[model samples]
Target chain A: MNIDPVKALEGKVERLGKDLKALDSRLENAQTDAAHEQLGLSNQLKDTTRKLGRTNDRVTELAESVHRLERLLVALNRKVRAGETRKADFGNWPEIEKKELAKIFQGQEAYSRKTFTPQEAKDTRKAIAEYDRRAHEAIEAAESLTHLPANAESLWRKHYKQWHAITDKHRPEVPDDDTHAKDTAAKSAGNEAIKRTRQQIRARIEDAVANDLLFPAWFENAMGPAAPPGRADDWLYTATDVVLYRLLHDVTSPADALGPAPAEDGHRKTLYDRLVSECAEYRRP
Target chain B: MAADPFARLADRQQSLRTALRALQAAGPGSPDFPALLTTTNDEVEAVMQARRDVEAARLTTPNRAIAAGTTAAALIVAVGWFDAWSLLSLLVAVATAASVLVDPAGRRLWEPRARTTVITAALAATLLTPLLHGWATLITAAGIAWWAWRTQR
Candidate 1:
């Protein structure tokens, strides 16, 4: 080894320079990589943020839909209850009509039995015609108003058809020269059948009530504590006749049997009271 | 509106109930009572009509096909566990199938919970044979019975 300190120092410095260059290159490369990684991370974060915003919007929409559905459910529940009450009220019409008819017929019958002058009889007939017209009008109103279940409607239709047949068979005719006797015979036969049918219906109603199969509280209230002792059958038959007339034909009320003016105030007032109560009950939840 | 007839009927029933409450609240004295009553009656008719429609709709072809598929799957599972336990599973599967077939509307049959119960029982029977021994099939019957009871309630 000759004395070459300067040369050796130069070599050492050159090696150090190379090492510094390499280090600098590594540091620069690392910085670039870090920057790329940060960019990637930023993009990912932005994507995630966008997705989160969409998710939040969706959740808000779903919550609104649930609220709407809840409101609908509450409204639907209330409607069902009201419909049930209305159905119950319509179901009561048959019983109410039966009770009212009973009173009307009883009044007509008592009047018919009393003697009256010609003028009074003519006035009575006119009143009877008016009552018949009213009865027909009531029936039309009921038919238009009532909407019964299928089974009940079918049963009603059958009864209506039977009533039409009975009325057609016994419709009164002008006393013609030759057909007067035949007309009388037919009327009597029809009346007998009507009476028999009324009796049967009354019996069935009584049986159903006695056996607790029916609980016509309204009917019982309308009938009051007691019907006149011997006139119960008459009352029932008269009511049945009223129903038949209402269903099928308009027949004169037996106002000829009624004296000058038939007092129907008691029966009318009682019926009105019962109707008001029924209406009140229908409104009760 | 619900596409399912039973669901439609339920909606109509709910509407009717609401109308009835409104009718009651209106009272007979209110001038609006008559109008409310008419609305209530209309709702009643709608409910009845919906019920009739439900009855008429009953089990459609798709429902029948699904029921048949379920029955076949049940039977296949039952066969896989052919033993004393198989009889119990088979009985349950057959009864469920029969009920689905016979009922006018397979409303309960189509319920997600009911389907889940039936499938779970079948899966339990299939998977738990080694661990539960013959008791796995019993689970099938019990599951079906529980589902039936729940539906009835």
Candidate 2:
């Protein structure tokens, strides 16, 4: 056991080196673990985003279905106001179909008669407006998280200031064009203006990131387009859009912005025609 | 308005908790096990997708230019000065030039085709500079040229 001191010291150094190497590997593993933790957090956020999108979609579908039911009630109300039978309005429907529709309408009248009066329609409009407000608020809240890269805020401020200066000097005046009668010329001008504005928007975006704006996770979760081109036949009109359109046009009922209900052959159908057609399919023999 | 996704998610969790409680209360031989399992699976998938979305969002780089531009344009509509707008044209031109110069990852600085197009556009702009009068024309010409070159290539 009486070993030389030099040899003993060398052995201790070798053991220390081995321990240091082991510690280094463990440290590397720890670093990797930290990276995985970061990834885990990011993954959790993504999961939330997807769930939100699904929920939003489901809600939109439910809203659209409710809107369709409301439309049917509204159409019935129109016939009642005109003092016309469902048969008279829906001419395309077979006699039996008209009767069936009448039965359906009458049954629906229990619900519609109570809540679908003109006053109720007005109330519905108000509710839809409120809903739109809430949606916009939520969207804005979600959009608030829109991340900007370094130096983006200052650049935006500068652009905002410049935009103020430009728009102040050149105010777009289209008061006359705001009327119900669609002015093609004004519309074209407005479109051109939009194009210009979009160009400006693109330029600003380009200036900021030299890339497309990062679509926020919440944005991805926002409800999908309600009216896809394929389903143009059964246009799922949201109550909000319909009410807003009617209000803006000062019309009793909103025009189906999603192209009017499908026409027969080459002839376009009126709202009355559509009501009849809808009634025909459900008519009883 | 659609139900807020966050709220909906919370509701879903609450529903799951309620279901789990019901299953527990019903004793060991609860017939709802299969349905619960299916629902749990769906939830897991949804959770996974949400996680993926989160990762995607993190990965996405925000375009500061667009944000600034949109903000500026919106503000202009709210409170703009039309007379001094032309003065800012120079600034816009400068911005456009700077944007082109600062291609992401310095790609524009490296790519040969991009360099050649930039040179050609600069030459064209220089030749037309005297006639065009303002930096607007020069910038516009360069931009158009660059865009056309890029698209064509």
Candidate 3:
């Protein structure tokens, strides 16, 4: 088949050549009779000016539409995040949408399959401080999730339970407040704090993608509450808060829970398993 | 053919491990672990006690300071506080608390905590001294007597 573009280019070039010849002839004739050709040149200049104005107007219209759309998307996310109630907020989300909401939902499931053995747990505890620090840096690099959006358009659906969750995860776990009186509570608090860092990393990822808010809740949730000293009947509610937040995230849509850890070999452990183990006492359901 | 419970248990346990392997690898096939679970409680408890004893034998005493502080606490309550020596008693109690402050073991037991506990006790004890004239003396005397008995014994 013949190429339309090449033929069109040839035709345009021929037309342009003819026009140039005409213009050249006119110019020559004008040199002899200059008054006749001046009006035609002015008319051509006006036509070009009108066409440029139309193109400029179209460009400006499209730019304005893009700017308006970007603002609308940001605002819609904030509204959706805000509308969530305690039970209803996370639980009611549709399946496919919630899955697509954050990378943690999609990315980390392979971690669970690792041989999540006691040996791994024992070994990990020693280096956990460093391990968690790296995880934190990784999370910060991912995205900013401050204003939080739900899957739907509801403005009243926002939820702050995730913030509460971080608080609960770091509660003083062992050395029961009464009997372990001789035991150092600072040690207990410190142990739980390390554990909490692992748990919060997931929630923060969720928040950053779902909300535009920086990790305010996650930061506040770090461990080491009042160490070594407590009144009667005091449990570290901080751990519970973190647990509840995770449970809330998890229970809502299994799809919505924090993603699994990266697979070490091929086992079925997850980030959720780590969170559950680290913040053991606080899990609600 | 087996000499004892462990030998019998080990054979049974071996079978159970095989079942555990199957369960962990895939799903419930021939369940051997469940049967062991029903039978092993008593044996487990006995084994756990034996394990604790072994651990206890190997375990060393905690830090020296903690032992010293406990000793001092026991002594202050037992000896120095007795015989109605109220001022002496106060001195002993202060000394005991101070030892905990200086000693690392005591730090482990009571450093961060008992902050409010000690403060409240001091405040309450201080406030009650004047009102508890005869009653207070009697109570103080009784405490001293108890300390004397504890220390002397």
RMSD values, in order shown: 39.9, 43.1, 34.8
lDDT of 2 by residue, B1-153 (tens): 114544443444444445434433443224554454345334433432332233223322332243234234433432443334333443444344445444411222113333334433433343333344345345545655665564352
DockQ scores of the candidates: 0.01, 0.01, 0.01
Best candidate according to lDDT:
1
Per-residue error (Å), model 2, residue B105:
97
Candidate 1 lDDT, tens digit per residue, A175-225?
233333444454455455546545655665455423334223343233322
Per-residue accuracy of model 1 over B65-106 as CA lDDT, tens digit each: 555665776566656756675566555655665555564243
Rank by TM-score, descending?
A: 1, 2, 3
TM-score of 2: 0.18
Docking class of 2: incorrect
After superposition, the stretches of candidate 1 with alpha carbons farther than 4 Å from their true spots are A1-285, B1-66, B104-133, B146-153
| lDDT tens per residue, model 2, A10-41 | 98999999999999999999999999999999
Tens digit of lDDT per residue, candidate 3, span B44-150?
Answer: 33332332232222221332333344345435543543434344434433443454345322212112222223322332332333444223334434433443343
DockQ of 3: 0.01
